[model samples]
Target chain A: MLDGFAGGFIEILQIATLMTMFVGVIAGIVASAIPGFTITMAIVLTLPLTFYMPPIQGIATMLGVYVGGLTGGMISAALLGIPGTPSAVATTFDAYPMARKGDPGRALGIGIFASFFGTLVSIIVLVLAAPPLAIVAIQLGPWEYFSLIVFAMTVIASLVGRSLVRGLIAGLIGIFLATIGPDPMMNSPRFTFDLAMLSSGLPFLAVLIGVYAVSQLLGEVEQMRSGSSKGEALIEERIVFRPLSYLMDTIRRPINLIRSSLVGVFIGAVPGAGGSIANLLAYDQARRASKDPDSFGTGVPEGVVASESGNSSTAGGGLIPMIALGIPGSAVDAVLMASLMVHGIAVGPRLMVDNPEIVYSIFVGLFIGALMMLLIALSSMRYFLMVTRIPKHIIVPIVLVFCAVGVFALNNRVTDIYLLFFVGALGYVMKKMDYPLAPLVLGVILGPIAETNLRRALSTSEDLTLFITRPVSAVLLGLAVISLVVFLRHRMRPRASADS
Target chain B: MSDPRSNNASGRPDRPEDDAAPQPEGISGDSGLLQFAFNLVMLAGFGYLFWEAMALPESRWEPLGAGTFPRVLLGALMLLNVIMLIQSAPQARAELGHGPRQLFGVAWRTMLEFRTVFTVLGAFGVFLILIRPLGFVIAAFLFAFGVQLLLGPRTWRNLVISAIIAAVATVGLQVFFAEALNVFLPRGPFS
Candidate 1:
């Protein structure tokens, strides 16, 4: 391992690989800073460019993009009060408030340092626990997978606005939408409704861009029309990035940082729970632990620290299962896996034995990528902060245009463009109706996996007891039940108080 | 992008009962009633989809047929809708307050309030329709330029900036995808 680690460092130290990694990281930051352009989307676009590079080099460069994109999301979330990526959703809760309150720099500073430390912690965990975790991950049956999704779905109750029923409705609608194409277990066309477009199911990218990005831009316009001052813009403070101070503060509150990072890593290791859930769950944990819990959503630095660290760490956490068990934890990880497969590098339990140098190099590359992201984000942050200075009207139209371009670029299908508008309209109505979009998006992403596993489990044995009989599956289901109960009880307490 | 922080805070919204419960939450009046009606329509749609799922061909080999999962989902969806219907029944009652004759008028007023949303959606719809025939670049430029021109006070300055941004953005994305990434974007008749 030591020899491979040394050799991998030598391998990555090559100038060409380093330069590409730098460029890829920069591009990721730029793309993810744009609202509606997700880290997954940026990685998808970057995949083709890496087709020509050698295996390790290509993977390293993409890794740069992945880590950079994760951090880049905080830029927009803090500055413009808009989450650049779904993972940064919680960052907006505090970062936006801080920025609007005239300290965008501090928000970004806290987020950046937190992201850096989070990545480091996840890397340490990844290096130490990946082999054993993969062994355990590979042991998960279809029952466990389904139960895992069930647990993940309970997070929707916390996320959905004031109404758990409305959230469930949104999530159910998402699951139904995902079921539109051929059945997962059987190739029989189930709900295509005889339309050619429905044959392949709705593209995930289009739905994400439509639901999150398009609806957001619309909200921006609505705000413009409602607010009296278009002149106020986003923020006007002379930005001051105090990285050392934020780092010190974060280190002082080691529990929040460690707990949030652990939440991210553990969630990331779980297939289907990626950064989206990680950030929120981490924030919720932080809120629950804080002495000043009420101060969270109102510009608390702890909230930003919890969210950014939680999300950034997921990159390494996601790689753990992928490198060890050959299962992808998220769509971006699936793409990363695909990139490796294209190079004929088989990923599984034997990956380390077969390519120790590659594994070691990837580990080293992660640290390098994280360090590079920190440097680039700090230097260019002033420039990124300048985006807030642009007037809303100008930003609005240009962003919408970018949305159109991005939608069309995915799948090269004009049908996707139509779907973007359709989903966008649905998102708008849902927004107006006080329904949460996150539940819907999560349901869409994880529904198929849940369905496939459920069917597989049922087919394997008609006995549904397999879910409960299995220790891990039972634990997960128990956890899901506990989560639902806690959420319900928590919600009822406030209502009962109001009623009395 | 969706600023869901306020929504996700999970604040306790007031719930209206069928009887003499004082107005509950942001959704107490006519809008709440409209939501109940919307749920009813959704219930009907889900019911229809459930019925349709019954007709899908089930493979003889698999123990669980393909339709089973969807049927399960539809059942859950239908149940959820019923709960929503129960919760918002008061709103539906309020809708009948001004007589059933004025329902259309109330809905029209609500729709009119979202004029900006509709107008923006209209421009997006036009862009979708135009993209295939006019190609991505032209459709994008037109949409950006048009939306920018209409959004706030339509200064010529806004027009110029929008125009430049639209053109530059459209061309840059097109060139980048085609030349650098080898992903060719569609070109219209002019190109």
Candidate 2:
């Protein structure tokens, strides 16, 4: 393992790998700093480019983008008070306020330091958590795997935003969509309805582009028509980055930094919960834990530290589940998994045994990427700040066209583009009506695994009751039921009374 | 879909100051009746799919046939849809008093409100239909220009610039994909 890791580090230091990583970092920073452009989109678009490269370079470059994008979000959050990404929503509560306080440099600087700390902490935790989890996952049977998916699905219902029913429905829709392809066991087509497109199943990349990018572009158009178009550039003044001064300021609030990062890591490790939840919850916890809770949203350094650290750390935390169990921690992790799979690397319990070199490279790559992000961000802070100058008119249509390019690029199939448009329409309607898209994607990914396991277990064993008789499976099922109950209780409560 | 941050889940700001009026689990506004109508349509679709699954021939080798898994899923979905209809009934009932004209106005207003979304979707539809016949370059150029024009800033300069941009970007991407990346993009006779 040590020898492999050492070799992995050597490979990561190669010129091609380093150059791609640098380019990825630049792209990630720029892409994510633009509001409506997500890390998932950045990673998805990056996939086609990475196909020809060696696995390590491709994965490492994406990782660089992952880390860079997490911090990149803070730029818009601070400068324009519009979070560049949903994860940066909490950052805006304080970072924007701080920037508005006439020290935009301090705002971004503090955020950068906090993000660095968060990533560092998360990497440590991921390294600690993944191996043990992987070991346990390796021991699980088909029944246990099916049960675990159920538990994950149930937990999704509770935390997946405003509507519990909508969340569940979204998940069910995903599972249904997954059922459209050939049956895992028999390879018999199930839901294709005799269409050529259905025979291959819905491509994840097209759905992702349709759901996120297309809908977001449409949303920008909607925002424009609403006459509240963010037409003018908010920052024209010279922007600066004072790393030394901000580093000192951030270090003074060690408790906030540590707590928020821990929060981020925990949330990131969960299946459905992600950076958006992490940032907000970390900020909330920081406020509650503080003596000066009253000062949370009003330009406080503590607030900025908490939110930025919380959001950034999730990158590492998200890697934990993906590396350990072959279950993607988030949509971004799903894309990362797809990238590795493109290289024909089997990702699962035996990933470590099969490919220690790749695993170790990822670990080392995380650290190196962090160092690069810090250096690149601190140096090019002003240049990135200028990216905000690009107008919405240019951005919206261009991005939509780019999304079409990405869709066509994926399979070179025009049918996929049609599917992209169809899914985009669904996404736009769902967004307008407040439906969650995550559960659908999750459902799509996990549906086949769940079904294949269930069928396998049933066929292998005589009794269907074995699922309940088995200890691990029973326990997992119990947890799933408990999650459902909790979701119900939360939904049923008269929060209206509490609000008053 | 858009945010992928916290907003991905709810399609709204995660930390809205007004905690009292929590966003509805279903579609917002005086649209419970509309939602219910949509649900009925879905229910009918699910029912048809369920019936089709029932007809799927089962093999003797596997204990659970291929249709079994999907049947289970469809059953669960059918149940959920029924439950949702029941839950939405009260709200839908309350909106029944709204006159047809009032409801029509609301629906029409919604369509107008979401004109950009529809227009963009239309552009994509046109792009998809044209891409094979006209090829990616021409289709993309037309789609890009139409989308921008509909979205506006439609001054003569913007239109000319949009046209030039549409042409350059399309050809540049095609060349990069074909030459640099060694991937084939659809080429029309003009290209």
**Number of the predicted model whose lDDT against the real structure is largest:** 1
TM-score of chain A of each: 0.89, 0.63
Query: What is candidate 2's lDDT per residue for A1-500, written digit by digit as tens?
Result: 57866887898999999999998888788777755557887788788888999999999999999989998988867875556666886677677657656667888889998999999999888787876643454566888878866765663553245555656677787788888877888888887889887788887656655765666566666667765553433343456667799999999998889899988887787665578667866876676567765466668899899989999999888888788878887889998899999999988777878988888888888888888999999998776566445555665666666667666766777787788888888877666655666566567656877888888888788587877888988998997787677556644564656767
Q: Write one digit per residue (lDDT tens) for candidate 2, span B1-191.
A: 42222334233433222222321323332256765776677789888889988876576777888898888888887887787687667667666666667667766777787676687778778888888889888888898777766665658987897788778877887887677446577887777
Model 1 lDDT per residue over A1-500, tens place = 67877998998888989999999899889888876668887898889888999988998999999999999988877876657787887888788888878888888988998999999999999999997876676678899999988877776665565466777888888888888888887778877788876787887767766876677767777666653645345566666767688778678778899999988988888777789878977887787577765576778889899999999989888989998888888889999889989999998778888988888888999989999998998888878777777777667767777676666766777777788888988887777666777678777877888898888888888798999999999999998888878767766886799899
The backbone clash count of each candidate, in order, is: 1, 0
Residue A374 of candidate 1: its Cα lDDT?
A: 89
For candidate 1, give the lDDT. 0.79
Off by over 4 Å in 1: A1-4, A34-56, A76-86, A89-103, A226-241, A270-273, A280-303, A325-351, A496-500, B1-14, B17-30, B99-109
Q: Cα miss at A333, model 2 (Å)? A: 12
Scored against the true structure, residue A184 in model 2 reaches a CA lDDT of 83
